[model samples]
Target: MQSILKQKIIGIDFSDYSIELLCIEKGFWKPKIYAYSRCILPPGVLFDGAIQYPAALSGILKKMMLSAVPNFMKNGLCVFSLPDSQVFFHEFIMPAALGGKSLRQAILHEVRTKFPMKFDDLYYDFIVSGKNHDTQNILFFAAPDYILEKYIQTLLDAGLTPIAIDVESMSIGRSLLNSRDRRKDVLIADIGSRYTNIIVYNNYEVSGIHIIKEGGEKSTNRISEQLCIPKAEAEVIKKQIGLSFHGQESEVSEIVADDMKEIIREIKKIIQYYLHRKKITIDTIVLTGGCVLSPGVQKFFQSHFWQEVEVRNPFDKLRVQKNDEKNKRNVLFSNVIGLALRGLHTYPHLRGVNLLQKARSHS
Candidate 1:
């Protein structure tokens, strides 16, 4: 495929744990990493992935963006991915005859039957994937209207323009897999601060996501409780002494081992259920997020799953000129990087659906 000429855009993402920002100058081939930064938010600013204190969080975000990209106001182009909990997706078949105005009516019909909440409360969009005989398979994604409104308000207050609000799981798939990867079914384990999103990438669109309530912070807390250390110090020490205890009697090692296994178990259960009902078997396993940084985590995952497990660095594909060793090594920034890639719309990956198109036009 040919390359996109050029554009400038930034991708911003935030969780209960922190705020992340990334910018790219899309060019002939690989896009240059224009600027990037990640800043930890104050405790209690976010709870369960929702902003508990919008004004203060907005201030923190503004300061971080200013320091990283001083000229952000000039272009102000960006995409934001909200916390995964607020974003929901489902796949359903639509008859080919309902391809026009009736398609919207069909979607609304599915919404009324599937979603407990009223249709008026949702902000939704759909992307058609493939046609089977007279039917079409489309992925539907929606987030609460109030959730989008509050977050978009915060972005505006932070002095940025958001062109699209994205689905987190799709962002993860786009960042790791490209056109070549479209031939295989890839399973991605995106372990975040408080949740691990298990995403299944079928040929084109994201097949499904199963959010496990286990993540980096949770493991740190367990280590602190078992080792009698402060949570801050526990985080540092957990990274220092990972799953490879190598036949030691250390309780810290035992605690860490159990936590890792539990996460793996949950993921396996989800995969088994999918296998029973589908023809696709997982082709590869990709691990992302800070939680997977524990020394032997990737090795342990491979041992249990008996597959090729890799810690993916999204920057490896981009044309980054600067010597930002930290950015190249960190996997936590995959979501934002994918967001920026979608903003460019150059890559061979499917043009993932955006939830913010309506909101952007209204603004």
Candidate 2:
């Protein structure tokens, strides 16, 4: 029997609250999304991008194989995203002469000596971002080793081959940037349940990331706490009334706005500093994750920053394999879609790193 490997790739993005899957099968034409599934994860399964309960997560993954994914795609090779909140990204300049073993040795030593965290505890990867007369820009990323192991075990238990692990910011960059025109410098504001990642991508490669302490969920929590409403009800109210208002004052909008002010402040600071230092302006602001679906969020960003803002829609350009696929999709799958794209290795311009380098081998 021929195992489903190279031809089909599954990209998975799972957070504390949900799991999204996309399987793209490459053929002669554009990559076709053969199967896709999304399901809500139970509370306590993942806490802040780290798996809290491995056995339960494995069980949930197994259920997806039986129910969400198609029978043929249940055992294919897959790539996953490491959430932005858990990974640290840094860009450094190395001698243009360094290559092969010497480059690796230099990067290894750099990480060992510079970063505050212990090198042994991290699963890391790097890619050369660009080059100049004497220096090559190297982008380095690392995440907790135990967290990656948990994810690998869960995927394996669900019968999927885990090929590589990627950082959330790079995955977002891959999906959002067009393969043909990679010239745009983008500022991605990925607002998640607990944090918002302010990522800078120059020419389709991630250059920097800034993490805001609280994010979209904080707004929902504020509404729930102040109004004395249930969380479920609060989420619905926040989404419905998100930063939009008429001539009169809206209580829900006010509450949401009040909570979002801190995040916006931090965002402005990052954007200002980046532009000032680099003397390069961002072409667009792409909004993704939990906050994007809310009404007027995209407009709010544009009005505040005076820049082009797009509410993330990972499926906007791709050709869906099935008509039913549209109904099952959302903005949150941008990271996973990029992970699948990474496995395909189609785009000539995009640069990414694979953290799972010797832990698992694939043909």
Candidate 3:
């Protein structure tokens, strides 16, 4: 693949439990990390993506800005990922009779009606997937006014510029697209700490994106409850054992296995529904998440789903220096790496089906 020449972009991922801040400077063959830092939230502060204590989060961002990007804090361009619950994504259609200005008007009208929040209560954007034969099809997204404003305000309040708000699923999707060609229908599942987000791309167009509440935390809690162990111990055990059933605690393993079975059933149901409704077969399943690193997860998923499966790795798109063995091994940072690529694409782009915003931004 050809190299993309561009500048640096700072990416920040804020979670209820931890905040991950990273910066990527431009490179010809590969991107270089300028800075990285992670901070855990204080206990009783916040839970799963909700800002229970804005002041606490703001303070953390403030300290992180001072420590992580001390030299160039002010006016630095940054982007943030919102919690899955606070964001909404849906597909819609407009009449074939409408084109050009008429189409634009129709889309805006649909946005006005379809969005859950009032027009004044959110910062909205969308992607035009393509025309469904004749009618225009689009994917719409809206983040609550307060959710977006809080991030912008937190940045402004701290002397950093938050230039964009995006979905984490799309950020990672861009990296996957850059590295591989998904000629057929496929599902990309990103199982994070609090939620598992699934994005279905058929022929390079995003057909569906679903966010499920089950994730790593759920597994941890299940282990904690069934094994009669502390949360921290359960967490360690989760990573070490995962779905492996290799340990002597047969009873605990059975309980964990049961929980995993439930999750798999739910995911399978979602996939089946999409396949049947859309009349598209899923050619493959790609898993990306911190959990994928857990022992035996890959084999477990392949065995249960009966489909080809793999982890997300963006190394194929980067030209690595032969001496940088450590960086070459860090495949888990694929999502953040993709988020960093946004600034270096030599063009303004939005991943997934945001054709409207892409055209609007470039114009």
Tell me the tens digit of each residue's lDDT in model 1 across 1-363: 342324456788788778888777666788876777778888898887677888998788777776785344334656877667777777788886667557766776887798786656777777776667798776777788888888878878877766677788878777888676678878899887678888987785577778888877777898888778899999888777777675552566667778778889998887777788766678788999887777788887899986578887787658864576666556877888888777677631235567764321110
Per-residue error (Å), model 3, residue 66: 4.9
| Full-model lDDT for every candidate | 0.75, 0.75, 0.66
Give per-residue lDDT, candidate 1, residue 328.
50
Candidate 1 stretches greater than 4 Å from native: 1-7, 69-75, 247-250, 321-323, 346-351, 358-363
Q: Which of 1 and 3 is ahead in lDDT? A: 1
Candidate 2: the clashing residue pairs are: none
Residue lDDT tens for model 2, 186-267 = 8888888788888887777666778888787877887899889999999988887788874442777777777667777888
Ranking by TM-score: 2, 1, 3
Q: What is the lDDT, from 0 to 100, of the residue 277 in candidate 2? A: 87
TM-score of each: 0.89, 0.89, 0.84
**Which window of 10 residues has the lowest lDDT sum in candidate 1?**
354-363
Q: Is candidate 1 or candidate 3 better by TM-score?
A: 1
Model 1 error, position 131 (Å): 3.0
Residue 278, candidate 3: alpha-carbon lDDT: 76
Model 3: CA > 4 A from native: 1-7, 44-46, 65-75, 96-101, 111-116, 315-332, 347-363
Clashing pairs in 1: none
